[model samples]
Target: MRKILVVEDEDAIREVVALNLRLAGYEVTEAASAEQALAVFSPSAGFDVAVLDIMLPGMNGFSLCETIRRDSASIGIIMLSAKTLETDKIKGLSIGADDYMTKPFSVSELLARVEALVRRVGRQGASSAAPEPDGRMVSGVFVLDQKSRVLYKNGTPIDLTQVEFQIMELFFANPGVALVREKILEGVWGENYFGDVKIVDVNIRRLRMKIEDEPSAPKHILTVWGYGYRWNA
Candidate 1:
């Protein structure tokens, strides 16, 4: 069974989320705060997803997400917030979350995002274990090592989140193709995803920070204004 951690301070909301997740057949663990989560979360425990609320009493969800992500890049993270501001969404994604959902969201939507994240995490994990017959794909200064799931830039390995890694895979596979935002979204987040399409934009921004010489003026991951983005390599 896939394991999930749900950290929400509100009892009712947490209970509802946990109940639905359990009913959906996930191995669910609940925490009322980030402190509680810290006590229980273990990378080796093999948690596939973490659903964290931003308004915790202490050590907010953003911090918890960062801590967990620093330890396990493969684990999928989803952030919850009552605020729908684009900056909040960007900050959450920049920190480490693979997905974000604002409050007043339906349980069904949350479940769908969790399901999509879990599938992505599983697929990425499986792919990392086996080396492709052609081990690496070289693009300028970048070297994507399929077996280790690591991207090397000029001999230095650039750390990539699971989502960013998948995006890189898609870009490398379709070089010079002007991929629309929806196509990128479906390619990385899967077709069953229920989150906003802007997620593609946020993740691309984050990925550029890691890979590009200057994120403010990206050269490789060029934006095709009025449409989408294309990998220049």
Candidate 2:
């Protein structure tokens, strides 16, 4: 069974989320505060996913999510927020949120997202090699190792969130090819997404920070003005 950690301040929403997740066959763990949530989370705790509320009594979900990312990128995180603004979603993605959902969302959609996140993580875990075009891809001194799901810069390992890894892999697959916003959305995330696409920009920018030698003037991943992003081989 997949273990899920739910951190929400509201009692009712937290209970509902936990109940629904349990019904879906997930082992659910709940936390009302960010501190408590972190206190409970460990690298070997065996949690497959984390469903976090953006708002909390202390430290907030964004910080909590970042902390978790710093520890492990293998685990999935879905940020839940009542704030529906594009900036809010961007912020969540910038800090390593794998998926974003606004408040008052359908339970079905939420469940689907949770399942998708889990499945995506599972695929990454199962793949002994990078799932990209023509074996593995490399640029400069950086190498994207498919089998291990690791990025090495100058022979040193680089830590990347799951979303960042996917973006990098996408770029590696289509080097120098301009990928449109819709294509990226459909590729990285599944279909039927009605949320803001600006989150893609946010995530791409964040991904650049890690993979690019200079984020200000990116060399590998370049934004194609009005088109989209291109990976320069």
Among all windows of 10 consecutive residues in model 1, the one with the lowest summed lDDT is: 124-133
TM-score of each: 0.94, 0.89
In candidate 1, clashing pairs total 0
Candidate 2 TM-score, true structure as reference: 0.89
Q: TM-score winner among the candidates?
A: 1
List, in order, the clash count of every candidate structure: 0, 5
Model 2 stretches with alpha carbons more than 4 Å out: 125-136, 192-194
Q: Model 2, 211: alpha-carbon shift in Å? A: 1.9
lDDT of 2 by residue, 1-233 (tens): 99999999999999998999999999999999999999899989988899999989979899998999888888889999999887888788888888899888888888888887787677663332344574455765777776677888888888776667777777777777899987877666656655567768888898788878899999878999997999885
Considering summed lDDT, which 10 consecutive residues are worst modelled in model 2? 125-134
